[model samples]
Target: MAGKQVMLVGVDDSERSFYALQWTLDHFFHSPSASPFKLVVVHAKSIPISAISLGGPGAVDILSLVEKDLKSTAERVTEKTKEACKKKGVEVEVDVTEGDARNVMCDAVEKHHASVLVLGSHGYGVFKRAVLGSVSDYCSHHAHCSVMIVKKPMAKN
Candidate 1:
């Protein structure tokens, strides 16, 4: 399966995601003969109705705003992903979709036929994770492929 794809890397604007992206490139792309896997960096941002409504009073205008924001976010994430890939000397294709993050991420994995999903572990305290239902947790239980949660090492003083 030298040319078979295997992994999808999900990225938000969070710092944790940067670390995860770095880890994935470092660990997975080192094998010269490995399959030419793809890296899909996604940024799923919710478009606030209030922000969109400022331009008009109709669904059409609101939808326009949402579309614009989605495109912009996608561009930004793609640029960042490209830069990261360049730094690692790896080539990857990026896909950015708009929707609920958990839903979009899972969908992307299936669409790409990914064998694994890589993501960062947000170091939410037990209480916070319990109360908010962390994204990593959601993906862990819901993703079709295997999930790898990369945790940032605590800085030592």
Candidate 2:
């Protein structure tokens, strides 16, 4: 007998990310064979408060405010992901971390012993991806487990 497999998904407050979450539930979690599995939804907070703090006293106050807002948002997104998964009859654990998305996700894969790491792509072009640095692209290359980059499905007529 084998142990439960873990599936880690990167979540955010984006339509693309929700679509990926749904796709993951439908594609992987729905099957009977996929039992004895655990799903982990993670949101990373990469706030650049260190840079903001370099400005002085006023900047320190602003940095604290920004950090608070970011933490609030991260909690909300994690709750949303948990609710969505619950509705799909899938159980999941949520993790909110402070770091770059790529590194955070990769670390989670290792920490959770994930069998697959799932996330969504924003469908950015080559130039945009180069400039913005795609998290999915980075995780696909770096994750310890197999990776699945789900794209938003187009609406049919």
Candidate 3:
């Protein structure tokens, strides 16, 4: 990609994600050779499950509480992302949307015309990934742009 292409990184409240973001910044943005990509950080704030119901009078209250918590977590993630970018002296565009991570990221790539979509991998095994559905996997296949999955290094014993 050339002429100030857009590079998007999908982040969550996970260390693996932050590590990937930092790595991208260090390798590409913080390098002496200025990258031609404009960075965009995206966080998918999950919508509260309407299907989750206690079937009691307090069910509404419980749902409201859950929504509030989700909102707070989204805010925290955004703030942390901002701090990370600031520390690197890199300006970025941050977008927070509500939906499944895979869809949100794919949509973001299209929305920004991102040349590359970077995501941190959870490294789930075959069975686990099949059960939980890996966001990175889905994005790699479904996204309109190039997808980069950053795997976290295993800790040395």
Candidate 4:
């Protein structure tokens, strides 16, 4: 246990994130002996900036509701993650934090001293990627650890 290097994976409510987690489990943890690395999964829950910025009537009320929704979503995401790990009979540590995903993920890598950070690729085009701000792209460059982006195979019609 002490000798294993840490492997951190960033996840969200997206299908792509789940796909990445599953892919990692299938490929890396399939060995007969104990898996090579200790696994940790992080879910970044976005703060409701819009509610705070509104500063209008009922803004505080809306903020509470938004926070509730965020908490609920986090619970759901973590539950699914647990189930995914259970499938591989792998023990996983799950964390939920409030912030932008990119920052949260990088912070996790630093905190865990992870050897590698895994993420899902949305495969956004250049334009969309630029506009949406790709989390995987940011982490790959900024994270202290190596990054593995798992891209799900596109379904054919």
lDDT of each: 0.80, 0.85, 0.90, 0.93
- Candidate topping lDDT: 4
What TM-score, computed on C-alpha atoms, does each candidate reach?
0.80, 0.89, 0.94, 0.96
Candidate 4, residue 118: Cα displacement in angstroms equals 0.4
Residue-by-residue lDDT tens digits, candidate 2, 37-147: 678898888776575857766887778778888888887898889788877778778988898888999999989899998999899999999999999999989898999
Steric clash pairs (candidate 1): none
lDDT of 3 by residue, 1-157 (tens): 3468899999999999999999899888875247788899999999877736468677888888988988898999999999998888888889999999999999999999999999999879999999999999999999999999998899999
Task: Give the lDDT of residue 4 in candidate 3.
Answer: 88
Higher-scoring candidate on TM-score, 1 or 3: 3
What is the number of backbone collisions in each predicted candidate, taken in the order shown? Answer: 0, 0, 0, 0
Off by over 4 Å in 4: none
Query: Model 4 over residues 68-125: C-alpha lDDT tens digits?
Result: 9999999999999999898788889998989999999999998989999999999899
Q: Best to worst by lDDT, what's the order?
A: 4, 3, 2, 1
Arranged by TM-score, best first? 4, 3, 2, 1
Off by over 4 Å in 3: 50-52
